[model samples]
Target: MDLLRDVLKGQSAKVFFSVFMALIFANPALASGLASGTSELTAFKDWVWTLTGIFVFLFIIVQAVRAMMDQITWLEFALSIVKVVVVGGCITVVTWAMGVFGVAP
Candidate 1:
């Protein structure tokens, strides 16, 4: 097509992102369309994320307090931080498992 030829020759691709084309692609076949009223969902997700950020700060403070109180060594507190990071990294494994079991479809 002329459009493809134009793109291959480094012409503008704005035609692909025109309003009408964007609306169609944004809806796709998903039940929750990207262009739909998804702000409510995003708000919920953002709140949960905000809570988790606060939790991480509390966790670090608690760990540092324990080190000061001699309940745990500073090295042990560092190891606990590393452990938390490893657990966070494990989410990729769970994601991979879910995909293998067709949860994404």
Candidate 2:
């Protein structure tokens, strides 16, 4: 019974080591095969713009509630507009670049 348990444990360890090595070898190959240039940069830019838009929208809503509409500062309004424009512009640019480069999946 003890020998059987040891054999089972050794088999499990071997299987685990095989899986770990396979993942280690596969990761670099996958990363190297991906698009690296403008595609990657544009993806990062779009994510930043999306997060900024969400933050600005939430801030505007909170400020509008905290202060009366007339008392709200122009800076806040300008920031909100800028966030919207940035997000929209990023989406447009990424879409155009993807089409122009034929980078679709």
Winner by lDDT: 1
Query: Ten-residue segment with the worst summed lDDT in candidate 1?
Result: 28-37
Can you write out model 1's per-residue Cα lDDT over 1-105, one digit (the tens) per residue? 977787688765565567457685676443466544466566777898689778877998899999999999999999978977887678668878999999961
Taking every candidate in turn, the Cα RMSD to the unseen true structure, in Å, is: 15.0, 10.8
Could you tell me which 10 consecutive residues in candidate 2 have the lowest summed lDDT?
A: 29-38
- What does candidate 2's lDDT look like per residue over 1-105, in tens digits? 854676587776766777788886677643454465446667888898789778877876876664555666767766766876787788789989998999962
- Model 1 scores a TM of 0.49
Model 1 residue 96 CA deviation in Å: 9.0
Quote each prediction's TM-score: 0.49, 0.36
| Clashes found in each candidate (C-alpha, N, C closer than 3 A) | 0, 0
